[model samples]
Target chain A: MTRFALTLEFDGAPYMGLQRQPHGPSIQQHVEEAVHAITGEQVTLHAAGRTDAGVHALAMRAHVDIEKAIDPFRLMEALNAKLRPEPIAVLGCAIVPDDWHARFSCLGRSYIYRITNRRAPLTLERGKAWQVSAPLDAAAMHHAAQHLVGHHDFTTFRSVHCQAASAVKTLDRLDVVRDGDGIDIHAAARSFLHHQVRSMVGCLVLVGRGKWSGEDLKAALEAKDREALGFNAPPDGLYFAGAVYP
Target chain B: MTRFALTLEFDGAPYMGLQRQPHGPSIQQHVEEAVHAITGEQVTLHAAGRTDAGVHALAMRAHVDIEKAIDPFRLMEALNAKLRPEPIAVLGCAIVPDDWHARFSCLGRSYIYRITNRRAPLTLERGKAWQVSAPLDAAAMHHAAQHLVGHHDFTTFRSVHCQAASAVKTLDRLDVVRDGDGIDIHAAARSFLHHQVRSMVGCLVLVGRGKWSGEDLKAALEAKDREALGFNAPPDGLYFAGAVYP
Candidate 1:
């Protein structure tokens, strides 16, 4: 069997999530059905990260094994053709070593959250970004985000149902910058717990709006209690930017 | 009566065109309806440019005369609230002079055409950009676009149904630039004929695709005949960027 790595881009408005579920459609189900139609082989597809509902991806990485002898370009073209009408595009495809894994062998992951800071309703950027009617201080948010870097117990930031065994993880980078009328929050880590990025972003927004100061944010982080969290951002603004491997 | 100038932003996918059409909905009709709903006055709306169907707008300029004693901010807020579920927004509103006109008083007009030059189909940018699968040489396109600049007979670049009195008009700027995987063509002039921008862009794409050369483009412009036109680009990629008034 040849393992083919695929780089995917999709609009998450239609799918339930990245992983397949019995409730509704997903990115996995669409891609798997396209592969089965092309190769007539029932195979499972594994992704570097399982994104939540209404979450987009710019370059989500995935690997699928197929016994059929097909060219990488042709496989990609066929899969893209079959995934039509749906907002999914295979940006690239290549053959990988047998031991190369998409999930376990990943060295790093990155995500970007978009927030449109304006009172005017979004027209061109609707559904693609989170619209915050209130003004945001990007510099202050950046200053507060630095405190969340490094190893710490992120219990206050993670979801109550998160399946990760440990509450402690090292955050390599967390940056907040203003782009045009919007703000971008970039997060990078080896791995992340469920809702960690959104939870942190929600609190950072409160700080930016002057509802909470940097000291208050630090105190909340030290509390390590879910009830101490300020807010939980919606999944609309988050994007799985890309995955890195060594 | 107070004449209010409004800066509008809209996704043009839902309307037939910017003008009040006899058969279908339009941007002008929607804005007029919103004004009537807010002020109880059936006012006529005039725009700086009447964009074609499926064309978007970033900062389209329009004017409406209202007899109601309402502030600019309140009018903008009310119009925005009524324009919801229609993908249209009033970005800004200001009271202009009684003689100020949205169409005739405009000194300069600018437009941007976005072309996604890539092999894969667009996902997030679907219906928002024109996707050209073939490779495009932006430098070559830019070089050829210079031939269409300056004063000349644009009959070959306008629709046959164009109603302008004279075919002679001066083009101040015509620049082609590459932005990531997309190419942007910016055109500015005191005014333009019907289908002028789309016609110019279609011929430029041919030059980019190597089907025509810079010399061929110059010859086409000199022909001054509508039959000399190569093609007319789709309305999907066109945007009424903005207008300037003296």
Candidate 2:
């Protein structure tokens, strides 16, 4: 069997999540079904990250094994063409060794959260960005983000349903900056638990709005309690930017 | 009656045009209806530019007469509050002289046209940008755009339904540049004939694709014939960026 790595871009508004569920559609099921239709082989697709519902992906990496020998570009084109009427596209494709796995071989993952901090309501970017009518202190938000840069038990920022065995992880970077009328939060880590990014962004947003202090954030992290965290930000502003492979 | 100058921003997808139309909803109708609902005044709103359907406005200027005595900021807030559920917003408000007119008192009008030149189809920005799956030479497009910068009879680019009395108009500026994966066409003039911006962009796109030369554009302008133009680009990419007043 030959391993193929595929880069994907999709609008995550219509799917339940990356995992297959009995109630709604999933990105993995559509991609696997498309591959099966083209190659007549049942392929299990593995992704670097599983984004929540209503999120988006600019470049998502996945690996699948197939028994047939096919051109990478042709396979990408065929799969993209078959996934028509759906808001998904195969941007790039390449062949790799059979041992290269999409999830286990990943080095890091990156995410970006977009927030429009404007007094007026969003029109063109209504469902695509988190809107905050009150003005935000971006400089304060940036200053507070530096406190969460190192490795720690991030139980306060993890989902209640997270299935990770350990609560401790290394955070490579966490940056917050203002761009035009919006604030962008860039986060990177070796890996993340469920709802980690959203939960952290929620607390930072509170800090931006003067509802929470940097001291409060520190205490919450030290508490190691999920109930001590702030509200989870909506999935609209979250994006699975990309993943790195060694 | 006091003359009020208002700054507006809107998504032009649901309107027929900026002006009042017999068949469908117009931006004027929405603004006027919202104003009447707020102050019980049936006033007509005049704009610096009359943008077409599917076009957007980042910052548009307008003027209206109000019989009620109201502060500019309060008027703006009340009008925006009453215009709930609409895709229009009053960004700013100012008091102008009685002689000030929205259309006639404008000094210059600026427009921007966006094109996403990429192989993959757009998902997030589908209706907000023009998607072209071919590579474009932005330098060639810029070189050709200079030919139409000075004063000339722009009949070749004007629509058959143009209502302007004279086709002779001076173009203050016309610039083409590439930003990341997109091409931006910026144009400024005292005024423009109907479909002038879209038609110019269409011809420039051909030049960017190496289908036409710079001299071909000059010849088309000199001919002053409608049939000499290439085509009218779609209205989706057009935006009334802003207006500069003296």
Candidate 3:
């Protein structure tokens, strides 16, 4: 069997997220079904990351094995055509080594959380961004975000249902900046626990609103308790930007 | 009666257009209905521009007359509350003189069109931007756009359905710039003939793709013939950004 790596982009508004669930429709089920229709082979797609519902992806990587030899371009075109009516697109396709797994071979992951810091409700960016009517101090949020960087036990920012064995993870970067009328929080790490990025953003939002300070974040990290953290940011603002390979 | 000016924004994917149409739902009908639902007053809203179907608005200006006194903030909040589920928002509201009309009193109007130039189909900006796989020379497009600026008879760019009395109009600004993977076209004028902006963008796209030159645009303008112009750009990329009043 030949392994094919596909890069994809999708609007996560309508699905139950990246993984296939018996409860509802998913990005994986639709893509796999499309691939099966094209190749006449039942294939399982292994994605680099499983994003939550309402969380978009710009360049999500996935690996699938097929028995037939197929041209990458044709495969991409056929998959896209079959996945029609669904807000998903196969951006790029390439042949990879049979042993190269999409999730295991990944070295890093990145995400972007968008927040529209304006008094007005979003029209154009309705489902795409988090709308905060109160003005957010991005600079303050950036300062507070710095404390959360580097290797640390992120229990305060991890979901209760996270399957990771330990809360300790290395954070390579956490950047908060203003773009137009919105504030973007860009995070990068080797890997992350469930809802980590959203949890951190929720705390940073408090900092932006002057309700919390850098010291408060530092204390939360030290406490290593979920109760110490602030609210969880809505899923609308989150995006699975991409995964990095070594 | 008190006259209130409102700055509005909407995603025009669901509505027919800015003006009330007998066939399909329009932004005007939605706003008017929301206003009546909130205040129990049947009021008509006059906008600075009547955008076509699937044409979004970033900062559309409108004026409404209320027979009874009302707080601008409360009225705006009530209208927004009632307009839920529809992608429309009242960005700002203010009390204005009876003489201040939404359309006639406008001094300047600005618009922006976004084009995603990439090989892949857009996921995030599917309806919000025009996606073209071909690589576009934005610098060349910018150079060509300069030729269309200044007072001139824009008959070639004007639509046959345009109701403007005169074809001659002053174009204050027309700029094409590249932003990341997208191209942004910004235009400003005292007023514009119907389809003028879209027509200009269509011609500019050709220029950017090396199919035409700046001299060709000049020739088209000088010809003052509809046949001289290129295709009209899709309404999805066009936005009524804002209206300026003196």
Fnat of candidates, each listed = 0.67, 0.36, 0.69
Error of 3 at B176 (Å): 1.7
Query: On residues B1-246, what C-alpha lDDT tens digit does candidate 2 reach at each position?
Result: 899998888878888988899999888898899788877999999999999988988888999899988898888888788766777888889999999888898999999999988776676676678977678999999999999999999999999999999999999999998997789999999999999999999999899888899999999999999999998888888889888877
- Top candidate on TM-score is 1
Where does model 1 exceed 4 Å of error? Answer: none
Between 1 and 3, whose lDDT is larger? 1
Q: List the residue pairs that clash in candidate 3.
A: none
**Model 3, range A119-219, lDDT digits (tens) per residue?**
77788998899998778899999988999899999999999889999999999899999987889999999899999999999999999998998899899
Could you estimate the TM-score for every candidate?
A: 0.98, 0.94, 0.95
* Candidate 3 structure quality by residue, lDDT tens digits, B155-236: 9999999999999999999999998778999999999999999999999999988999999999999999999999999988
| Per-residue alpha-carbon lDDT of candidate 1 for residues B56-164, written as tens digits (9 for 90 to 100) | 9999999999999999999999999999878999989999999999999999999999999988888888888898888899899999999999999999998988989
Order of quality (DockQ): 1, 3, 2
**Candidate 2 pairs with clashing backbones:** none
Cα RMSDs, all models: 1.2, 2.0, 1.8
Comparing 1 with 3 on TM-score, the higher-scoring candidate is: 1
For all candidates, what are the clash counts? 0, 0, 0
Between prediction 2 and prediction 3, the one with superior DockQ is: 3
Any runs in candidate 3 off by more than 4 Å, and if so which?
A: none
True contacts kept of 1: 0.67
